[model samples]
Target: MSGPLVSIIIPFYNDGYVNQAVASALAQTYPHIEVIVVDDGSTANQHLLDPYRSRIHYIGKANGGTASALNYGIRMATGEYIAWLSSDDIFYPHKVAGQLGHMLSRGALISSTDFDLIGAHGELLKPQLAVKFASAADFLRALHTFCPINGCTVMMHRSVIGRIGWFDESLRYTQDYDYWLRVILSGIDFHFVNSPLTAYRWHDKSGTSRYLDQVNAEFGIVHGRYVHGLNGLIARIGG
Candidate 1:
């Protein structure tokens, strides 16, 4: 019941797996936590949240992209730390505890961990699917090619928002990538924890699956903006 309060923000948008997501957040081994479910105009699945109405902070807003909904939830979060759990994702019971411990132990303001990939029915497709980095340079280099850090696996201090600013609302599909690039460019170390404490569901209905072309297009724009600078850093670190 005691520790720095952790805010688990869930951006809901008609995902059928939302209830399971909320259940996982509520089931965290770490007790000092608040789950904020931002309903971004979910027409069909809003009713699924009825059972959790009393436990979580449910905010209904006009349909917005994931970035917008996350920004809204961040604005409303009162915790010292924040973590995002996509409505279709699942957080292991030790997620908050493990990540927070890893961050605090190393004096890290922001951190992300390895994650498991799950099928639509929550069956494990791949365990520890995130590429592990042997050194900081490897991680930074990986960023130039792909987003090795999963948004759902990330946890950061509230001040990170103040430093890097919120997710770019203009970016519909690649907001998380844009935010990570900004954070890295701001000279903040993105500490990586080796454990997989989150399960990312890969379903056809998921945004990444349904809009692969758009995601790829947006990723190009976001990655191009940072590749030059990140390459410089990578060169320095590798040397």
Candidate 2:
């Protein structure tokens, strides 16, 4: 049977490693895939994308933020499923195939897999670097403190967008975290895949490393908005 088309959306800024990211998305072992790279008004390193212009769908927009870029790319996606990949990160060859298969088998609308941490030079800093929660309740409970789902490691069906809506453009740093909270509150449980299928790059230039204070501030804001709702969810889950 033919598999569904998965749109791998890459939200790019001025990151120099965008070429590698695009390559990885294009290299997915899953044959039915489309690579969409949304360039968020990148001033430099955009020339690197020229080589694959013919092979991938490319979008250029004003520099709003990652959330805006993601929303734009997702809106343009024609695939049944949406997957986000950062410009500096990479998807393993089987990332889509494995995760998509897991979602299909489990009848999941949204899912995320474990990921490895890679250094700036692409050295493996840690393997399968995800907190293994014993149950969905454990995962939801932990959300009150911090976000466990990596946006790049997540894949969701198009229906999820209809249900939970798009990422909050107002959130500069914690859009992914805010989105996950919304997903949970919408009564959709995230299906976890144990395989480390994506490489999360940790470097000085990464947003988390450079804007720690701002990110933390935004995290606090997002947490405040959803804490009550999520707490009730945890209570209902017997946490």
> Best by lDDT, which number?
2
* lDDT per residue (tens digit) for residues 4-94 in model 1: 9999999999999999999999999999999999999888888888899899999989998899999999999999999999999999999
Sliding window of 10 residues with minimal summed lDDT for model 2:
136-145
TM-score for each of the candidates: 0.97, 0.98
| Candidate 2 lDDT by residue in tens digits, 25-115 | 9998899999999999999999999999999999999999999999999999999999999999999999999999999998999999999
| lDDT of prediction 1 | 0.93
What pairs collide in candidate 1?
Answer: none
Reference-based lDDT, each prediction:
0.93, 0.94
Pairs with steric clashes in candidate 2:
none
In angstroms, the error of model 1 at 227 is 2.0
